[model samples]
Structures are given as structure tokens and as C-alpha cells.
Target: MTLRSTLTTLAAATLLALLPHTAQAAEPYPDPRPITGQEIIHDPTVSRLKSGGYVAYSTGGIIGARLSEDGRHWTDAGNAFAEPPAWWYEYNDKADPWAPDLSRRDGRYWLYYSVSSWGSNHSAIGVATSRTGLPGTWTDHGKVFTSETTDTWNAIDPAIIRADGKLWMSFGSYWTGIRMVELNPKTGKAIPGAQVHHLATRPDAPYAVEGPYILKHGRHYYLFASYDACCQGVNSTYKIKVGRSTSVTGPYIDSTGKPMLEGGGDLVLEGHGRYIGTGGESVFRDRGKDVLAYHYYDAEDSGTPKLGLNTLRWTKDGWPVVL
Candidate 1:
């Protein structure tokens, strides 16, 4: 160790310390819980039936359905309706309905769904009721809300929430992000003349945010929505984001205090590993735990859309984490 060499070594160490340190790579996201049997699904909304087992309704086949006795092993249960209603053809020439939401209230199961053609804003959300929440038992109740090409908002993706003792439906896609309108609880229909409230959107064109689901946790209402592109299978870029507000109809703010209406949301879940394009989410309670129901494109299965479920846990600071 010559003195010159020691001095040179010290100088190099000092220079190394002065230079910026390399950032450590972030941890990869956890994969969805493995599921089996009849997992093919898209835009799935799941509910734990009062009669035991779970039923999921999604976008396809007059509102395609899947049933699970244990919430892990699912089997195809056919479609919600044997045939689409005559009015459905007004929006969708094929009479196809998409994104059915099911909830139980007052001893009856209420279902809300949307009908529309691809890339069109002329859409309608309809309501139905069933005694058992089964696929074929639902009785169509006609349109609850609608949006035309002239309207700024597109009406699809119906999500119902009872906040502040009032029923509200949050729905929208692409045209103007997410919007909400009050509903008549008795009829499970939109209240005539009720004001439409805007909840979330992006700043740029083709706003990219939709599939809004609101969950009331503690005193704050959390708004969860899918962001970015969808339906491209392996290329789909869909992911889930969330924001929270003190009011049901809000200025919901993200973790950084950015309002949801201004495109601010905290990332809750995203595609990672074999799961790609994870979105189209809904929350359901089962056996005292809040579960997140969503669909992900499976890379291992050649980008097939499949069911994904996670236990949604809340942090000490109130943010949600999917596990």
C-alpha cells in the first residue's frame, strides 16, 4: 500500500459516494390466487348468494354467468337471460347486455346491467329483480338510466352503492369517465330529474377510466376504477386504481390529495407475472371479509380472460391493499 495508491483509492471511494446511487428495482406485484374450472370470464361482478355459494355475472352472452359453491371452484351457469329484451336491440343490434351488477336488498336480489354497441355512447342501464339471484330467475324491470350520442357521458358499467342512506348508481365508460345519479331504492331505478354527478376522469382524450365501484369503509367512501386500455387480451393494459372521499358524491382525492375528477388515483392492482390487464372490479363480502372480484388475462393460458379474486385489506392509514 503506497501512499499514492491509498490516496487514489480514497479519491475513487469519495467519487463513488458523490455520484447518485442506483435505485433498487421495485418488488414485482403478487400473482392472483390460482383458480380452477370455468374461469373464463370478463368484467365479472360477483356476489355471495343468500342461499349459499357465489354467482358472478359478466359481459357476454346476454350477461354470462358463473357459479361457485366455495368461491374458488367455479362452473358455468349459463346466461342471466335466455334472450335479450326487445329494447336491448335499440342500442346493441345483437341484443347483447354487458356488465351485470347484482345486490340483495329487502329480501330480493336486484340486478343492473348495460346494453350498447361497440364504440358507441348510445347506451342504456336496465334493472331487474330475482327471488333467488339465480341466472334464469331475474325479471326484467326496464331501463333505469340512459345516455345518447349527444350526451357527454356514456351510460354503461352500472355499480350500485347505498351511501348516506340514499341509493346511488355510478356508471360510465370512455366518453366522459365516471358519472353517478341517484336511484329510487324501491324500484331500483334512477330517480327522475335527479342530478348527474361526475366522479372521476382523465385529463386527456379517450379518458381511459371506467368501471367505477364505490365502497364505504369506516367514514370514508373509496372509489375504485379501472384505468387504461382493455379487451386486447395479451396486449390489454387495464389496471385498477382507487381514491377516497368523505362524501359519497365527491371530489374524491387520491393518496396525494389529487381529485379523482382530475385523474388522480392510487394504484391498487395491476398486471404482473402471468396475469395481464387486470381490471373490471367489484367488491363483495363473504364470511366477514371483503373480497375483490376482477378478471385478468392469463399469459400462460394464451391471454384468455379469467376470474381473479383477492382479499382486500386496509392499511392503518386507510388505503386498500389487494392480497
Candidate 2:
């Protein structure tokens, strides 16, 4: 080769090395990985264990739970409660619980679960704590907050978050979207003087937003919620949506700059192919990345609800994407 050509090649290589390299963008909404062993769960929440295992709880009788030695393989850990709390029988006919939130704090596991009946606003959120977080060791703390028939919000799908030096819970369902309230850190119940704050809602009849799980990323508190009709098997139109705000109690807005109170949300995950009706999401940090966990109807498996997990990607503009 000519000396001039060799010099040109070296210069080009040096320039290429000096320029920053960027990885290829991940596929949007990449298919969730299959979870092995006893995987039926609705409105699931997962927490990483100190022993490097994972424990998950979901909506069911006595709050069904599963434990995983590795994040991939799971075994039935039984129910968080042996039987439903007696107070729950007043609201729900079957006395079954739904949408349990699991978290660990100060060397103990704190679980917040919702007890309510179908198509009714008479509901209550309850707390239970356990030293080991394993099945059956939890000591029930009874009802934390309850709603009467006159109330506009249904107190279900409890999620606890510690932000701004206080413990707060965000919960609600179809009646009036999602709501938040400050909680007594020591008792894990609502603070006496603090008032309930409204978050997101759809004004249309039979409002469809629910399952409020908040995750703080950088300067924003992102609210992840399920939208549309849930629980109809394959016919379910459920999907996941998100909004963010600088404050924990939000006037949460979407990427388009529309407030969530006006029915604005950025789509995170929805049905694709056999992964139908993807909703009931919770975000958990594993290793260094955020993992989005939920349940999807398996079109290939008789439309049964099963576990779904995916890595969450954030855009430079500060929005969450499932990848």
C-alpha cells in the first residue's frame, strides 16, 4: 500500500476510537421471560431477599406467595395469611385479598394488602409484618384504611414508598383512579393529621386506572398503573401505563405534557402476540437495573394469567420504556 494511504487509514482508525461508542438500542417491549414452577399470580409484587433469593406476593385467597432461589425458578411459599382477617369478611363475600405490596424495611418485611368485594367501594387496606417474609410468619396489623359506601375511592392495591423522609401509601381502583396518603412510619398506617391526596383518574364512567406503584428514578417519581378492563382472561384489554411528577404526591404528567388527572399517560407495556392483556405491574430493582413484574394472559396456554418480567429502560427525555 502507498505511504499516504497507510497514514490515512491510521488517522481514520484513531478518529473512530476517539469518538464515543454507543450500544444498539434495546428492542421495545421485549417479550417477558418465562418463569418456571407454580406461576399463577395476579397483581404481583416482588422483593429481593437478603439471601439473594426473591419473594413475590399476589392477589388471592390468603395472599398467595412464591419464593425463588434464583430469580428464574420459583416454588410455592404458601399464603401470607392462614385465613382472611375477620374484618375483611364484612366487605368481601369470599374474604379473599388482592394486590399485595411487599417491601422490606429495618430488617423486617412489611406487606400491605387490599380486601374488597367486586364492584363495591367498601374496601380496606391492611398491613402485615414478618421478620423472615416467608409464608405464614406474618403478623397481621389489621386494617390500615377503609372506605365506606359513600366514599368516592376504593382503597385497594396498596403500595408503600419512602420518599422525602416519610412513608406514604398510594392505592385505589376504578371508582376514582389512584390516591395517596401519608403514613405513620412506625405503625405503617395513615398519619392522623395528613389528608388523602388525589393522584390520577379517568373521568369517564367506569374509570379504568388502578394499581399505583411508584418508583423514584433520578429527580422524578414515576407512577406505574394498569389501564382498561382486567380479569377477563384472553378477552382482557388490560395494559400498563405510566406518568411522572417531581413530587411524590403528583400532578403526574405524561411525555406529551398532559396531566394525568385529565386522562394522560405514556404507554409502557401492552399486549403483543401471545402476551395478551399485560397489566398489574410493580417495579423492583435487581442487581443494578429495574425489573418490571406483572402478569399476562397466555394465549398459548388457554389464556391463563402467568408471571411476566422485563427490564425497564429509560429515555434521555425521562420516560420509562419496557425492553
TM-score of model 1 relative to the true fold? Answer: 0.91
Compare the candidates by lDDT and give the number of the best one. 1
Which residue runs of candidate 1 sit more than 4 Å off their true CA positions? 1-25
- Model 1 clash pairs are none
TM-score per candidate: 0.91, 0.90
Tell me which residue pairs clash in candidate 2: none
* Residues 108-166, model 1: lDDT tens digits: 99889999988999999999899999999989989999999899999999999998789
In the order shown, the candidates' Cα RMSDs to the true structure are: 7.0, 5.1
